[model samples]
Target chain A: MKVDPRGQRFAAAITTVVLAAVLVSASPWLLALQAVVFAVGAGAGVRHSPYGLLYARFVRPRLAPPGELEDAAPPRFAQAVGLAFSLVGLAGYLFVGAWLGIAATAAALLAAFLNAAFGFCLGCEVYLGVRRLLPAGRAA
Target chain B: MAPEQVAGGAAAAAVLVLGTVLALVLRRRSGRFRAARSRGVVSAADEAAEGLRLTAEDIGAPLGERATLLQFSTAFCQPCRATRRVLAEAGALVPGVAHVEIDAESHLGLVRRLGILRTPTVLVLDARGAISTRASGQPRKADVIAALGRAVQ
Candidate 1:
């Protein structure tokens, strides 16, 4: 299914806030909460995620319809990327050194901020770059 | 309250500030067409050595009499959708101009050979198939028209 790019950016804005809080507060529980959000986003479809539902219910109703719809695959893949980083961060917070958690969460925060402020989807770009490099990806 | 907490807070603030600066720089530069020779992502020698001309048979599409807007896109790129609209409109508005969209994922060989680093990378080819200019990211309509002007001239 296709998604409204505006909605995706809205979700990213919220994500930027949550990730920033995690980094500044050094809150393991908060990061764990965000990891769950990423899990739902990746395990299920993006439309089924909490932020997606929030955008659909409260935010999207007030805005004009998006000019163009984008394929859900890229954003979905982006969710998976976020989930992976959160997991690494969670591991760092729970078991490893605090520095590891800070670094990982900081990286995720950078990506989220870019999407929120500039509409640049780093995860989506990584998805395309990786696909372009894969040998098996040559076939249509 | 602790000394470590103060240090951590300072570090986090710095990271966010740095990200903002980087995003601003990318925003300023993204989607602006540049001369193919000025591309820094791939060495100019690579493209120069391979020859800058593309054939109709090579891209699996026919060339235009005056100019061709060749777009390399991927399934997951949102900007590619917007870009398709701009290029298609330009192609329709201009005489002897054609817009051809290539799936970058499916054309890995061509993508690598041409040093295409991202989706929505547009290559403006002149009548003889020499790449005149290219841009990575979604370009404005005026810019697309301007690039076409350079190509068809």
Candidate 2:
């Protein structure tokens, strides 16, 4: 299945806010909340992703149909990447130190910001790089 | 705000500013393709096609009869879908022009060799498998047509 590209951007916009809040609050709890958000989006398909639902219910109805929809795998992979960063960052803040938490959120913030503002996919590019390095079809 | 709070605020602002700048640069670069060396000669298509070398293995699929609009895609790049549609439609309009979409990761070897830095990168190939032109980002219909003009000349 495919997704409206705008939905991904809408979700990214929300992520940018949550990640930015993590930096200001410096609270493990807040970061954990953001991490859980990532987990849900990554675990469920984009159709069930909270931000996706938000886009479907509130945003899509207000706009014209998308020019075309994109494949689901890449965005799903992107969500997995986000989940990894948020979870690791949450771990850093909780067990390691404040600086790690700040750093992690900063990284995630950069990615979310790029997607929302510029439509660049830093994590998606990283996903490709990783796939290139690994032997073909190793896990799946 | 406290000293720590001031520092955090500064970082937050920095993220936003950097993001804005990055967006500007990407916007400038997206969907622009380099012009081919079309000499306006009737046989120029054959000349361009001479140096081309691609097969089903290179693009993860077979080439079209007269030309191929080979597209490189990734699991996460959204623009690839838009580019695919344009290429597909263009291919249908022009006889013998075929569109092939390749997963960047699956064909990483060819992707790296071709210097494909982003998804939706397209390589317009002539019938003989010569690379006629390339666009690094999601391409517009006009540009695709122009590249096809060069490829199918």
Candidate 3:
């Protein structure tokens, strides 16, 4: 599916805020809430995610249409990466220790902040990096 | 209010600053063409050893008479699409420049051999198929024209 890159950035900005909040408060419930957001984004699609819906309804109307649309797979893969980090963070907070949770949340926040502020999608980079490493001749 | 809350606030501020600084550095570097090692210095034997020369067969397209804007792109990269438009326009604007885009996903071996780390990686090749300059990430049209000047010169 094609998506507006701006909307993805919008979602990332929201994710940056949410992950930062998870860090400052060290709240497992809030972190869990973000985990669900990631799950929906990954499992369903970015278009169906709450932040995406918010952008579609509220934010997109105020701005010009995107100059171009991009494939949604990379950002969706990024959402899965976020979900992985959030799950690890939840595990850390609920079972392991506060240090692990904080570290994981901080990592996720760094990634989201990069996408939000700079249009540098760290998760997308990782996705491409991993694809580069796979055995050649396979369809990506 | 509390000591812990104060520390949390400070940490949050620190994270924001760090992200901003890192983004600034990356933004400054991204999409700027960097001249590769001077192809003039490399002896014929060394050039053969390095395999820096790409042929029309390797890229699945004919080279331009003056310069070729050879781009490596992946399936899901957003900038690659934009880069295609920019390079195509640039190619068309100049008389002897041609743009060729390769699917980096399908050409993993070639991508690894060239040490391409990201999508929208562009190599400007002169008539001899030697790489003159390259940029990783989306490049501006002006920079591309400038790079072609160096390539064709």
Candidate 4:
């Protein structure tokens, strides 16, 4: 399965735009918009089209060496990290106020942008780091 | 800077540093330190017959006058696609050579039994149904032809 890099770029662009709109609008309506965008993007990713299937199946595997196959998928960790960031940001917004939440969100968005642009998976790196610190048997 | 703002900035910085350090330490300690092994090519005879559980009857039954070439592939395997193309071309070149592609995902148990850890594996069997050569990763055209020649000889 061959992955078209352009497809990934397009998906990232859509995710960024939707997320930005949600943050700027800061309204209940924005949540609905975000949900719609996410659903459409995820649906497209899973579509049977050649590019979509290729992106879903082959893109991430090509990132590593041939023999060093990933023991587990990376997206699961990315989702966990994303959820943690969202919760922390929400807490900061509710308790510390809008400015702090905005700052944290901006920082996170910047990091995500850099990662997508440069192919530097910060979340994966962090996950590997944490895995290393765990006692041998506990680490996955 | 206001005293309160300074405190806040310092706190955020502390959190960031702590998070990064913890992540790094954890990753390092999580896995066993294992050195990589060499990618040594295996001849047909060198392959463990018991582990493979693949006999001449199983492979030879499908091959009608033409020799049989079985290729194992994985979903996300780039080299596997390349190998498929190469084997397809080889099949065209050799008289009575047929290529069969197998998805490793559906046959994980077989893969484990064969001790196949990598994708794009090519298995060549002679007309008599004996395994001739087993190449891992993308095999060079010349090497594959040479192996076939040896098997026929």
Number of the predicted model whose lDDT against the real structure is largest: 3
For A1-140, candidate 4 gives per-residue lDDT tens digits of 22344444434444444444435643324434433433443343323333334555766455553332221223223334544554555555567765555455444444344334443334444442343344444211
Off by over 4 Å in 4: A1-43, A46-140, B1-61, B64-66
True contacts kept of each: 0.54, 0.44, 0.43, 0.00
Candidate 2 Cα errors over 4 Å, as ranges: A53-70, A136-140, B1-4, B35-52, B60-62
Best by DockQ: 1
Question: Which residue runs does candidate 3 get wrong by more than 4 Å?
Answer: A135-140, B1-11
TM-score of every model versus the real structure: 0.89, 0.82, 0.90, 0.40
lDDT of 4 at B118: 57
* Candidate models: Cα lDDT each: 0.83, 0.77, 0.85, 0.49
Candidate 1: docking tier: medium
- How should the candidates be ordered by DockQ, best one leading? 1, 3, 2, 4
TM-score of model 3 (CA atoms): 0.90
What are the per-residue Cα lDDT tens digits for candidate 3 across B1-153?
544334444666777899899888877877899987754677756764675877797788999998999999876676787899999988888889989999888877778877888888999999978888899989999999889888888
What DockQ values do the models have?
Answer: 0.56, 0.42, 0.49, 0.08
TM-score of chain B in each prediction: 0.85, 0.80, 0.87, 0.60
The residue pairs found clashing in candidate 3 are: none
Worst 10 residues of 2 chain A by lDDT: A131-140
Steric clash count of candidate 3 = 0
- Candidates 1 and 4, the one with greater DockQ: 1
